[model samples]
Target: MRKLAALTTLALFGLSGAALAQEVTLRAVTSFAEKTTYSRGFERFIERVNETGKGIIRINYIGGPKAMPPFEVGNALKNGVVDIANVTGAFYTNVMPEADAWKLRQVPMAEVRKNGGFDYMAAIYAQKMNAIFLANFVGDNPFHLYLNKKITGPDMAGLKLRITPVYRDFFQAQGATVVQTAPGEVYTALERGVVDGYGWPITGIFDLGWHEKTKYRVDPGFYTAEVSALVNKTTWDKLTPQQKAILQKAGEEAEKEGVAEFAKLNAEDTEKQAKAGIEAIKFDAANTKLFLDKAYEAGWAGIIRQSPEHGPKLRGFFSKAN
Candidate 1:
């Protein structure tokens, strides 16, 4: 009787361990600071997952470089160090050179949001990266010229402008000396007069306090930046069908909330920037048309010549959306 009791106890303990192993907790990382719009969306995603996951699955967010650098997020996810990450599509251009084709193409946010482009991109990302694309949030803030001195038109020929690769050629073509600088270093560069201006997302200027060093803001509305949230394939595969369903439902909820939040915050921030005394320059009709035409021509032509395979699909997607 004592031997039978011992065996039954061991069996029950083993079953308990097995049951505990089935409940999973996932880690997600992102490069956005806690105050940034991206972080807000991430918070919403986490809330949705927790509310609907029924305690079977949990997601713990690790924000910014404190967890992992923006560029390293993909590698972290793949290695199982982190189960998910949020990243800008532009940052992964090195891994998928064809990614630049998607970033550079000028597609109106409204049209892209209405069409099935987000779903299509999600599918492509999943197939290529062996991860589930959770959401594609539209960043509406345009890359603007933040200058130290007020200048009209593109004739400020000698101005040294700090820019990323996407805008490097465009700025050079406009007669500005281009200086490549990371987002974090822009303020010091501007204060020290290493560059006359920096081309950046308008929100970044405010977020990083670069607005304190600059006076003018130009709204050329050149192109939009694409940001995405992805989950690891291994982690996703391990999820039960019920868990997967919960995550998918949460992702869709986050998408709607994110789009609305971004739109509202963008408008409010623009107003705040204006009130803070930063001069806002809206390109006149002629300049707007000229800028868009030249930008599209240079951007698309360069992508097709460089990444022929993915370039055509990217062009088709943008063209249809436009």
Candidate 2:
């Protein structure tokens, strides 16, 4: 009688362990702080996933470098330190040379979002990173010029400007001395005269307080920043067909909300910037044409020349999307 009782308890313990092992927990990491619109969108995605997943899959979010740096998120996801991550493809140009293709086309974010460019990019990402593509969020606006002093088209000649790698060629082509600074150091660099001007997304000027130190902004909006959220391939493959369908549906809903929110917030913030006393210059038609002509030529040429191997494929994608 005692042996039979012990056997029954052992059987129950084994069943409980098996059930617990089946529960899936996903860890997601991002470099953006929780307050940023990008991070907020991600949170909404997590909420949708949780609701749709029905407790079979749980996502645990870890935001910002306080958890991991933006650049490191890719490796973290790749190594399984985090099951998923939000990463900027441009940052990984060195690791994946073809990434430069993203910067090549001067395509508008709205066009890309509406025309399946995001899906195309997702396919490339999946092939290169061994990850499952989920969703992409376009920032509020395009990158523009912020100067510490008054500057116009011709006046921009010989100005020292701080820029990221992708924008370096664009600035250099415009006759500015390009200085590379880490994103976190831009504000201090501007204050210290380390750079006379900076080029970044318009919304970032207000977010990072660069507007306070900058006196002029050019409205020749150049490029949009694209942010992507992805999950580990191995983990994604483990999901049931129904589970995948639910997550994909949640992603589509999240994308719609995000795109709408971004458009609304961008208009509001543009007005706020004007109220904040920075002069916003709208380039005249001639200037606009000149800028676009020069930018497209320089941007596309640089990418093709620098990354000839992947340039054809990228151009094909951009041509179809554009």
Candidate 3:
């Protein structure tokens, strides 16, 4: 009788522990497909959290753009259609025009946190989009222009470029007619002559097979590109304090790994693009300076125009001038 009671008691305790481990499960989505560079950061973050969170929490990933349009993700987070998302600010500028200022970030996210930049963005997201600004997953990789048609200098005359909000004003200022196309559609756009080129970081051309159509990469790349993780405020509030801490800590770990690996990949990508038949287009030093200055100038002009109150305030956090 004593042995029977002990066995029953142990079984119940084991069942109780199992139930306690699964306290919450949150759904996550990325703006791009899972196997792509843009999704790498979020993938690592999810890995860390799932490992560390074992019984406490589990993130249910629902896949990417095919699951939902990239541009709709910001609204999805705002409206609570999903608990978490990985996306670039450029894709969701409608949620916060001040977001454009992030592309201008000249510092790593670790420094941004120490300087209170992260706190400020967190507050902004809470108030404006009903989301929590989670860790910045990847950044500091500058964007270069990939073109089928060549230009000897900064002049982009007679070019039609596919623009993300990251480079709309800058590209337009340089005499290019800009079109917006979804990532999956860009290949068709280029093939169909809807765009002569597109703006992208050094790393993704081969990933999307754009190198097949790309003939040149403009040197002296422009503004930094970044991807960030966010959690819906409602979902965030529902998590236990311990669960929140696990997520926060995992995000930091993932970002550190992501940034370092991304830097290494950027170097390899440039080399790979060259071997894949993409040429490096360049201009003299004088022309290079002229080009970069025009880019940053028009970039800030458009940002401040759209977000008069916060754009200037953000320059301190996001720019070298700060």
Instruction: Return the lDDT, model 1, position 210.
Output: 79
lDDT of 3 by residue, 226-291 (tens): 888999999999898889999999987777877788788889998998899899998899999999
Model 2 lDDT tens row, 89-157: 655554455555555444555566556665666666667766776766554356677887665563467
lDDT, model 2 = 0.69
Candidate 3 C-alpha RMSD relative to the actual structure: 4.6
Q: List the RMSD of every prediction in angstroms.
A: 4.4, 4.5, 4.6
TM-score, one value per model: 0.83, 0.83, 0.92
Across 1-322, the per-residue lDDT of candidate 1 in tens digits comes to: 9988866976877656335546678898875666565566776777778777756788887667666666666667656788877776555554454555555635554465557655565565666666777765544545667787777665558889987666666777778898775566778998899998888665545777877888887777566665667788888998988888888787777666655666776688778888888887667888878877776676677667766766676777776444
Off by over 4 Å in 2: 1-11, 14-21, 103-120, 319-322
Clashing pairs in 3: 21-55
What lDDT is reached at residue 320 by model 2? 34
Between the candidate structures 2 and 3, which one is better when assessed by TM-score? 3
Residue runs of model 1 more than 4 Å from their true location after superposition: 1-10, 14-21, 101-124, 320-322
Best by TM-score: 3
- Candidate 2 residue pairs that clash: none
Most accurate candidate by lDDT: 3
